[model samples]
Target: MEKTPSACAMQWNIELERDLRSKKPGKSIEAILDIGPRLEWWSRESNLHAAEYKIFGLIPGEDKLFANAILLRLADAFKSGDKHMKICIVKIFLSELKQRRQLRGQGRKDEGILSKDKVDSYRELLTRIKIVFDSGNIEERALALVLFGCWAHIAKDSADVRYLILSSLWSMHILEAKASLFAAGCISELADDFAHVFLEMLGGLLVSSETSRTIRLAGGRAFAKMWCPILLADIAHKTGVNLILESSEEEFSLVMLVSLSKIASKWTPLIPRQVELLSSFMTKDRGLSLQVIALKCLRFILTKGMYHFPANSNVTLKLFGVINQLDFPPALHFDALRVLCKILPPNLDTIPCTEILTIFSKFLQIVEFKLQSPVISERVFAIHVLACIFDKLLGILKDRSGIGSIVSSRMLTFTFDRISY
Candidate 1:
């Protein structure tokens, strides 16, 4: 339970802000750091006020003393501070939270006089922050939630903070997207009460064309980068996959596909599902960005061998059409070709050996055209992809006797006509 701010604490809050602002250089504010954490009226108001300023007024430094002193009374200030003052307190606490994370990252122990009994103290401080967060106005609540998400990496009591985060994220305020992404990254311990609502909200944002593109993309990115990993942490695979599949917008789906490919590398069963779903977006009509991302994700999934891709003639032919089209960006062109290469040894009945050779032959003509262009990278990328096709093609021609004469004869004629270009 959190303590309500007493009248004396409110008075000290004023004095503290004032004294720190007025404190002159070389004045010993050490007395402020020495004041015990207890909020007692017996202590002179002027002294606590001076201490408060002394601790907060100084710029943060490597030394933990000032940070520790401020944290000691921070919860009290949070309970009593006015709106602006509360924001200031939130800033200081968040800064300390960042420093704590940095210390852990550096492999340094939490070292300071006040930090000797750190766990209990920091936990209590976070509890106070949570109390303030629950009771603050919109701006205050959003800011406090951001602070919690920022510390999501190290906070042990995150389960307590998760629902509040979900509420803020659900509001879709300008602040919600960022705070949600941060929380999604940090709050791996989120409860299903929070996760269920959050996934639903993200799904709606991602699927809705009415939602701002920025927010939609952020939702997709957050789900893949942060939410998927966390939900999958405890075997909640269906929840994450379902949300992604439920989205309707092309951009949102593309963003989610890219995110899923990055995180789902170890989750093999998901690869084909992602590939199959993303294949629809690899069409001539999809936006270049969506097409590129979808194809890239498909390529990534196949290259990683995350799943055994059984051949689908319809999907294979669609990819072939995307490859055959000239309107998509060159990178996407390469990605589409790469996807074809990855799903090689396709079931011949579905994606026939002859059809594969024909695609590669046309693919060569595309590359040969690029080689004469000024963009050296595209030329180089195209040549590299073309080379890979030939290498793969040669092996296929050698292994199978049925299409050897026709494919080899056509390959020779195509090579003679375009290889020098």
Candidate 2:
């Protein structure tokens, strides 16, 4: 009887293992070359998992010959196999790289260092990936951008590799927005030598009215990952403010806000400006979705750098205005209350009686309005917010000060009324 395809594949896996165990690099390489076509065939048949598992399983000892074989097979897969095949090969490469990194961390210095042969094999793989990048369909090119970025991270110390990666950034304009995003994401790894050039490039894309929202967001994320002070300053001085106040696109505003939030811990000098921008979104005129995102960004900024929040009364009153806007969606209300909770000090002694009364009155109004809501969830949410407010200000509420006495009495009346219901 003719051997089934699975049987043939199994037989090939067995022989491949034997050759690897024989401890002869020449024999193992030959066996890998011999099985290359079979692996490609299996990938085409959508049975790549078995062959991939067997091959990876047999090569865990950092066998140089196995590494070469894997690279060669990767090239073959990219050249002829389907998209799934190419993706599987890329994942294997990444997984192997991660495992090697872990080994290095464990003090396996020899295994961690890239030998000359290993570097050469990676160079060959990069060449093949670039070829696909230049000529492949959009999906393939997007995948290639990811592979290129990973290669940049792995070969970061090499000047030649850095140059190659930088050269790809110029071609980003020709690619679709999604592909360009992948390329943008890779810039953080190359920021040491090429930060200024990339900053100008990414910054231009971020602030340009003509740039797509997707690309703007991509640039924002890239800046967030870099954590460079210069980049952060540029974002604060120009890109973020432009998006927040000038751009009509809500998504662009949201992307910039998110980017700012990620770096909020280090953005003390610009906290007031950020608060001003976020307050604009919290107004009744803005869309609910944008308001919600603004509230979240505000919360992150307040929680991470509360000491930096501007001490101005205008800023405090604007936040109070957010909670008092009963017409806003429940989500906005909840997030706004959360932001208020973050900004309010646990020890309220530093605040004056009039300011505390202002805050307490606004929150009391919110609780009163929400309690009367016909929706059970709204009432529950009100209870939760009230509990949070009480928890946060319990110290002052229990004090003998006149402000505390007034707040305590009002809270008692509300709590008793809810219980009676």
Candidate that would win on TM-score:
2
Candidate 1 wrongly placed segments (more than 4 Å): 1-120, 153-159, 169-181, 189-219, 225-251, 259-263, 287-289, 299-320, 338-352, 419-421
Screening candidate 2 with a backbone cut-off below 3 angstroms (N, C-alpha, C), the clashing residue pairs are none
Clash totals for all candidate models:
2, 0
> Tens digits of per-residue lDDT for model 1 on 246-271?
75566656666777666566466665
lDDT tens per residue, model 2, 162-261: 4544555444454545454454455453455455556567666666667665666666666554445645454544555664576777776777777766
Task: Report the error of model 1 at residue 410, Å.
Answer: 3.0
What overall lDDT goes with each candidate model? 0.56, 0.59
Candidate 1, clashing residue pairs?
A: 16-49, 20-53
**Candidate 1 TM-score versus the reference:** 0.61
Cα lDDT for residue 139, candidate 2: 71
